[model samples]
Structures are given as C-alpha cells and as structure tokens.
Target: MHIAFVSLETVHHRDTETNRRLRTICELLRDAGHDVHVFCAPHWGGDHPQFEQDGITYHAIAESTDARSGVAFRLPIALARAKPDVIHVTATPPGQVAPAAVGAMLARTPLVLEWYGDGGVFPHRWRRWAAGRADRLHVPSELVATWIREQGLSGDSIETVPNPIDLERIRSVDPGEEVDVVYARRLDEGANLESLFLGLAELRRKDWTATVIGDGPEREAYEQLASDLRIRDRITFRGECSREERIAVYRGAHVFAQTAEHCVFPTEMCWALASGCVGIVEYHVDSSAHELVEGLDRGFRTTSEAELADAIVEAGDLERLDYDETFAEYDRSEILDRYLVQYRTLQDEQGLL
Candidate 1:
C-alpha cells in the first residue's frame, strides 16, 4: 500500500505531539513494507525537491518552512501526482485540510485526518471544516473523539487510536531505586504539581518518600512549594530523565500521581501504570487523565487534594509489581495493527480493496 502523509510542518521543523505522531505512523508504515511518503515544507538540507531518510521519502512542497499558504497551494497537486492509495493529513494547520481533501478527491484516494486536539489554538470553524472534509478522523483518545463530535462530526467518522508504548523496553529495563510515590511531567504552569504536593504534605507524618521526574519553568516554584510544605527533603527532583530512567522510576514507585490542569491524553500516567505503579489521577475540567483509571482496579481517580492523598495511601495496599500486562494492548505492534486495520477499512469503503 502507498500512503502519503500531508503536514506543512514536519518534526524536522519543530517537535510537536501532532508532528511526532504523524512521523511515527509513517515510519511504522514504512517498516511494515508499505510505500510511505511525507509531503511538507522543506526541512531537509540542500536544494533537493525530495529527500529520502530512514525508510520513507519526504517531498518538499514549499521552499520556506513558514510558507504555509504556499504549501497549501502546492499540496493538492503534489498529493495528486504522488497518487498514493491513501492520504493521511495532520490537522495542525486546519486550513490545509480542504486542499488535502481536494487532492484526495482528485487522486480517488481515502483521506484520513489525524486530529490530536492538542494543536495550538485555531478557529472553531477551521476545525469544524477540517473535520467535515476528512473521510475518517483519528484521535489519540476518546476525549479527543468527543471534542470532534462537539465540532458537529458524527461519532461514526471518528476513531480512537491511542499512542503506542514500547512494551519490550519496559520489560527489559531494570527498576531504579525505589520511591513510595512518583509524579512525572513538564513542570510548567499547567503541571499542577501543587495537587500532588498538597497530597504529600497531608501525609507529612507518614513514612513515605516521593520523586518528581520532569523539569520546566515552574520547577523552582514546585520545589519551593515542597519546601514551604516542609516536605522538601522527602521529595527528590530528578528533572527530565530519559525513557528508561522514567520507566525505572515508575517500576520502583508504588503510586504515580497525575494532576495536570489540561491533557489530551495522560501519556506519562499511562507509562507509569504500565510500569506497575498504581495510578492516582486528579480530575480536572480540561484534563482527560482520569480516563485511564475509570474502570481499572490498579488505579484511582480523585476530585480533590484530600481524595488524592487518600487514594495514594490506599494504593499502598495493592501488591507491588514491576510490570503489568493490562497495557500490552497499547504496545507498538498492537497500535500498528490498529492503524493497518483502519487503513484497510477505509480502502474497502472506497472500493479500492
């Protein structure tokens, strides 16, 4: 199968969740012996109109990275000429979806839109138009799928395909030194580390230590909050550790707390849960973190600091595990199979099978 991925900005231009997810899907397609090509503004060196890297080919639709309108103008022709079996486009610049749809129609190919719902602010009309244009929409979580439905798209057109986790790596890596509780994420204003800090502060009399596993502008503020709570010495700040490092910490920790103010999907919390840490997520109006713990016995969802602290303490009663098989459904192979299934379904609907 030939798959064409349309995104004005590639991961080479800037690293973003939407770009990374598109790249991952394209690379996975390439690895599975499918012909994959990425159409985007030039992110490669030299004057080449096309560049092949890793297993996939990237076609430069515009010379400048900032030339979104130029890219949009050229994409329809480029995509039609590429003549892929299916066209997968990112909704980063929602304006480009209409052009990509034109190309797909011209090429008589299925058009699938990847909308993570985390892409920076765009007009609601643009999102609604993009949702309406694509034959199918791929979202990372049910939360995002709901958002798409709110855009007036039918639930039938939206599919929830989650982010893939490397289960093999989680199995192979050894656990790092243990901590009673762990919280990991960029410590930005939206981090909401205060929820966990207050929860921990409530347990000052208890004999438990915690670890914070990320860094950002708000790290100092978070640390100072811990100090002011008088539990600074009990909390270790290991900012921005590698994947393995994080997995090890998760393996060692008994509970993983997620309190972010906003999240399309609680990816870090998912990782921690897969590593055997009992998940404790705080509910936020804008966050979908609690979705991971809804029906699971190994996790808890809390609505306040008191509930979070109680959940953390209750999590101690569960057996400590180094790894859990429940999340194996989210492994790379499983996710890749899901994508292939979606692609085949789209092809069948188009009578191209």
Candidate 2:
C-alpha cells in the first residue's frame, strides 16, 4: 500500500509530539514494506523537490515553511499526482487538513486525520471543520476522543490509537543503578512533583532511594522541596535523559510514580510499565494516566500523599521484574498492524480493497 502523509511542518522543522508521532508512523509503514510518502514544506537544504531519507520519500509542497497559503494550494495537486492509496495527515495547522481533503478527493483515496489534541494557533471552528473533513479520525486516547466527539463528530468516525514504543530496546538495555522509586517528566509547574516529594517525605524512616528523570524551569524549586523534605540526599536528579537512559532507570527501579496534574497520555508511565516497574499513578481530574494502570495488578492508583506513600511500600511486596512482555502490544510493529487494519477497513469501505 502507498500511504501519503500530509504535514506542513515536520519533526525537522519543529520537534513536537505530534510531528514525532507522524514521523514514527511513516517510518513504521516504510519498514513494513509499504510505500510511504510525506508531503510537507521544504526542510532539507536547497530547493530540492524531493528528499529520500530512511527509505521514505519526502516531497516538498512549498518552498517556504511559512507559506501556509502556498502549501494549501499545492498540496492537493502533489498528493493527487502521487496517487496514494490512503492519505494520512496531522490535525494541526488545521489549514493543511482542508487542502489534504481536496487532495484525497482528487486522488480518490480515503482521508484519515490523526488528532493528537495538539494544534497550533488556529480557530476552534477550523479544528471542527478539520474533524469533519476526515473519513476516519484517530486520537491518542479516549480523553482526546471525547474532545473530538464534542466537536460534533460521530463516534464511528473517531478511533483511539496510542503512541508506539520500542519494547526490544527496553529488553536490550542494561538496567541502571538500582533505585527504589522512579519519577519522570519535564520539571514544570504542571509536573506536580510535590505529590511524589511529600509521599517520599512520609516514608523518611524507610531506607529507599529514588531517581528523578527530566529537567525544566521548575527543577530548582523541586530540588528545594526535596531538600525541605530532608530527603534530597536520597534522590538523584538526572536531567533530561535520553530514551535509553530512561529505560535503564525504569528497568532498575521497582516503582514508577506519576503525579502530573495534566497528561493527555501517560507515555512515560507506559514506558516504565513496559520496563517492569510497578506503576503508582496519582489520580488527577485532567490526567489520563490512570487509564493505563486501572484494574491492572501491576498498578496502583492513589489520590493523596498518604495513599501514594502506602502504594509505594506495597509495590515492594509485588514481584520484581526487569522486563514485562505484557506491553509488547504497544510495540512499533504491533502499532503498525493496528494502523494497517484501519487502512484496510477504510479501503474496503471505499470499494478499493
């Protein structure tokens, strides 16, 4: 199958979660022996019409990245010429979606828009229209799916597909230094690190060390809080670790705590769970982190510092593992299969299968 991905700005232009997700999907399809083509504004040096990297071809739709109108005008023609079986686009810069819709119609292809719930400065109405334009809309979680429905789209139009992770890497990397607890996220105000810090403070009498992975503006304040709790020495702050570095810590640690006030999807929590860490997630009204661990034996959901602390202690009684195969379902290959299933369903609906 030949899949055409439409995005005005890609990971090369801006390293956003949505862009990364788009790139990952394209590469997954490419590796699975499917023809993958990405139509976007030029990012490579020079005025090249097309650039091939990692077995996927990127077609430059516009010369300048800021030329939104130019991209909108040219994308449909480019995609029509490519004549892909399916057209996949990100739900950002909502302007791109309308043009992609035209392209899909011109090429007689099924249009699928993936809404990660992250969009640039665009009108709410534009987002709604973008939602309406797709034959099938994909979201990362049920939370985002609810948002999509609120846009007045039918339930059948929206599908929830999660971000993929590399499980093989989790099994290959050696565990880092042994630790009792692990917490990871950008150390921002929304991080809500105080929950974990206060919980750890309650267990001051216990002999356990933790590793905090990530860096941000709130790092200093969090460190001060840890010091005030007098457990600063027991916590190691490894700032902004690479994926491999984080997997090492998650594999070595016994429990992974997530206290973020808001999370569209608890990706790190998923990673930690896949790496064999007992997940301890603090329930928040806006956070969807609990979705990953709810009703699972390997997870504990808490509402307060006391509960969090107790959950941590209880996690120790559970069996310790270096790697959990249960999460293999979220691996890239598995995610690719889920996507392929959707593509085939769309094709069959369009009488192209």
Candidate 3:
C-alpha cells in the first residue's frame, strides 16, 4: 500500500509531540512493508526538494509567507505526482482541511484526517464544511470525537485513536535521583502554571523540591511568580529539554503534576507515567489527562488547588508501580495495527482494495 501524509511541518525539523508522532507513524508504516511518502513544507533545509530517510520519501512543498494558502495551493500538485493509495492528513486548524480534501479528491484517493484535538479555538462554519469533505476523521480522544459530532459531522465517520507511546525507549532508562514533584508542559497561559506554583507554596510546610520542565512565552512570568511566592529557591525551571533529558527528569520525580486548562492525551505526562512517576492532574473542564489516569492506582485527579497539593503530598508516599500493564493498550505496535486496520477498512469501503 502507498500512503501519503500531508502536513505543514513535521519532526524532521521541529521538536513537537505532533511532529514526533507523525514521524513515528510514517516509520512504523514503512516498516510494515507499506510505501510511505510525506508531503510537507521545506522546514529543515532548502537544498533538497525531495529526500528519502528511513525508507520513506519526503517531498518538500514550496512554502510562502502565507503558509496555509501556500500549502493549499501546492499540495494538490504533489498529491497528483505521488499517486498514493490513501491520503492521511494531520489537521491542526480547520484551514488545512481545504487543501487536504481537495488534494485527495484530485488524486481520487481516500482521505483520513487526523485531528490532534488541541487549539481551544473552534472552527468557523466554512472550515467545518471543508472538514466535512473528508471520507473519515481520526481524533486522539472521545472528547474530540464528541466535539466533531457537535459540529455536525457524522459520529460514524469519527474514530478515536490514542497517540502511541514508545514504551521501549521509556523502559530503558533507570530511575534517577528522586525529586518531590515535576511539571512538564508548555508554560503558556492555558497551562495554568500559576495554580501549580500556588499549590507548591502550600507544600512549604513539607520539605519538597520541584522541577519544571518545558519552555514557552510564559517562562519569565512564571519564574517571577515563583519568586513572588518565595518558592523560587525550591523550584528549578529547566527549559525545553532533549528527549533523554525529559525522560530522566520524569524518572527522577516522585510526582508528575499537570494543571493544563485543556489537554488531549498529553504525551509528556504519558511518558512521565510510563517512567514510573505517580500521576496527579488538576481537573479542567476538557482535560483528557483525568481519563488517562482515572482507574490507575498511582493516579490522582484534583478539583482544587488544595486537592492538588494534597495529591502531590500523597503521591510522594506512594510506591511507583509498573505502568507497562496499565499503558499496554497505547503500545506503538498496537496503535500502528489499529491504523492499518482503519486504512484497510477505508480502502475496502471505497472498493479500492
């Protein structure tokens, strides 16, 4: 089978969870004996318009200042050239839907749009209409699927495929020296890091230390907040770590704290849990972290700042359990197999098989 993946950018240049997942899926599919091709803007180097890495081909679509329009204009030409059996597109904003839908149509290929369920902004009616043009939709969680239905898309066309976790890489690391707590996420406004800082201030009575891992626009403000709270001495802000560094931090921490206002299966938190850190999430209206850790023994969901502090304290006393059993369903192999099934099903339905 030939599969074409359309995205604006991928992990080939940027270090984001979405791009990393896209790279992983492409590699896995190629490993399974499928011909995989990626159609993306030339994010890394300008020298090569096309290149091959890890048995998958990447075709660089010319980029313009207006990237959305640029990709929309160029993707159909690339799709026609690749002539893939199926088209899989990553839809971040609803705008990408137009190019992907049109490109797949031009190629006469079945289209599957994977929605990461981030970006709290809702799509405009026209964007939703463009999305409705796809043959099927793949979302990371049921919450997202529900949102899609509310937008008037058929529920039957939506499939919930959780992001894949590389358990093998997580399992290879040994637990480092222990720390009291760890918070890993973008330090942006939506992350609600101030709440975590306040919760940490409450833990002053207990001898505890925290490591905040991640960088974003709010880093300076968050650091200043820690100072104002006088907990700055006890907290270390390690901005944007490498993959190994992140895993090491998770391995060293006793508690993993999440206070995001909205999350769709946070990959960092999952890595923390898989690294044996006890999970604690501050409940938000649309958070999926609660769902991920709900039934697990080493997980806690807090509704208030007080509860978050208490959960952090409670987590310190708990022994780290083997998350392999708890997170088995998210194994990369299993996720790849699920995608293969979906691909085959769509192909058969369209009589392309």
Candidate 4:
C-alpha cells in the first residue's frame, strides 16, 4: 500500500520525541515495502532545498511554509498524485490536521492522527473534529485515549500503539564497572528535572557520583540548584552527547535513574533497561512510567529519596536481565505490522478491500 507521511516539521531540525517517533515510523514503513513519501517545512536552523534521506523521500513545501499550511497547497496535490491508502499525520502544528483532513476528504482516503499518549495538548475540539475528518486515529497509550475520548472522539475510532524505541548499535559490554546513577533528558519546561537533581544530591552526600547527560531551558537553573544543594562537586554534566555516547554511558553505569516530574518516560527508559542497566524510577502516584517497568525488568519504583537512593545502589549487584526479549515487541518490524493492521482496518472500514 502507498502511505504518505505529512509532517510540517523537519527531523534533524529539532531533537524531540515527536521527530524521533515520526522518523522511526516512516523508515519502518519504507522498509516494509510500502511506498512512503514525506512532506515537511523548513527545519529550525536549516533552510535547504528539498531532499530525501535513507529510504524515505521528502519535499520541502516552501521557504516560508508552515506545516499546518503546507497541507492546503502541497499535501492534497501530492496525495491525489501518489494516491496512498492512508495519510498518517502527527497530532501537532495544530494547523496541519485541518488541511490534511480536507485533502483526504477530497481524495476519499483515510487520515490517521498519531501522538504520544500524554493527555495530548491538542484541543478536544480539534481532536474530535480531526477524528471526524479521518477514518481513524492512533495514540501511543490508553491514558491518552481516555483523554481524547473525553473530548468527544469515539474510542472505537482510536487504536493504541506503543511508541518506537530508537535502537542504536548496542554491544554487550560488561555491566559491573561502576556504581553510578545516570539521568538523560532535556532540562526544559514541563520536565520535572529537579526530582532527579535533588535525588542526585541526596546520593552524592553519601559519596556517590551522579551523571547528568542533557541540557535545555532549565540547565542553568539546575546547575545553580546543584551548587545550592552542595552536590555540584558530585555531578558530571555531559551536555548533549551523541546517541553512541549515551549507549556507552548506559553500558558503563550500574543504574539508570529517571524521575521526570509529572511526565511519562518509561518508553525511553525501557531502552536503557533493554541495554542491561538496572532501571530506577522515582515513584509518583500518577506516573505511568511505573507501569512500563513493573513486571518485565530491573527498574525500581520508590516513593522516597532514601528508598530511591537505596534502589540505585541495589541495581549494581542485581543480575542484569535481557530486556531485548521484552522490548523486541517494539522492534521496527513489529511496529510496522501494527501499522499495517491499522491501514488494513481503515481500508476495510472504508470498503476499499
């Protein structure tokens, strides 16, 4: 089947969860023998002529193109020409959904919306309307589906799929090297980084060295807080390392500690667990991250700093398990099959079969 992805944002232009998922989906579909085409606007710091990468082909709409606006002008024409069975779009840019809905309407094809199950920030009004425009919708979690259904979308119209784990070349390295805790996430708004920071301070007071491996809007604030907490000397801030570096750090460390205040992060942390690090989650009542690691791996969910710190230390000696067996369900090939099921479902509903 011909499947075209309409994304207003460029991939390399931004380092974000959305970009990573979209790129992974497109490439996986391409590998599965589907004809995948992409339409994107200019990247944040990049303004280059249109080009394709890997197996996916891309077209830059225009110099001043907005992803939302790109749909009205470029998308319908492309969809009419390429004639895909379905057009899957990310639930962002707030503007892309409307135009793409209309394009699919004109082509009489299905439009499916994709997003992380974070109680999507998109308006219920828009999501409901977007659902009406498309034959179906896709979300990464049941938690998100509940939120969208509350906004008037029918639960039957939505399918839940797990987010893709961006796999890197992981080598099986010895896991008993050091007793360290590693935190890797953007220190930005909405990211509850302080939980990890203060937790780090609590550990370092006991003479442990915590590694912080990312930077963002709250970088300086976190840095200052580390100094104020008197744990600055015990932390190593390796600002923005490449994917390889992150995997290497995971292999060398004994534990991977992730506690993002009020955000769901188990999907990313699962990669760390799969790579053989004992995972540690700072427990919170509403944290869906806890649910991801409960039964399959070596992650600990704790309610207090003492319990958390103790868990970190305990992770070092625990026998490392092969999470590859657990997470293999989310591998590129598996995700593609789930997607193909969605496409076939849409086709069946529209009587295209």
The pairs that clash in candidate 3 are none
Q: Candidate 1 lDDT, tens digit per residue, 1-353?
A: 89998887888988877888888898778878999998888777889999999988999887765535576678888888988999998887776777788889889999998988787433546556766878888888888877767756788888898888888999999998888999998888899999999999999999999999999999999899999999999999999899999999999889999999889888888888999999998988778888888899998989999999999889989999989999998888898999889889989988999
Compute each candidate's TM-score over C-alphas. Answer: 0.96, 0.95, 0.87, 0.82
Off by over 4 Å in 3: 9-21, 31-33, 44-49, 60-81, 92-96, 119-126
Which residue runs of candidate 1 sit more than 4 Å off their true CA positions? 66-68, 120-127
- Strongest candidate by lDDT: 2
- Local accuracy by lDDT, each model: 0.86, 0.88, 0.80, 0.70
By TM-score, who's the top model here?
A: 1
- The TM-score-based order of candidates, best leading, equals 1, 2, 3, 4
Q: Locate the minimum summed-lDDT window of 10 residues in model 1.
A: 120-129
Give the deviation of candidate 2 from the true structure as CA RMSD.
1.7
- What is the C-alpha lDDT profile of model 2 across 107-126, one tens digit per residue? 99999998887662225565
Provide the clash count, candidate 4.
1
Ranking by lDDT: 2, 1, 3, 4
lDDT of 4 at 337: 88
Model 3, residue 131: what's the lDDT? 66
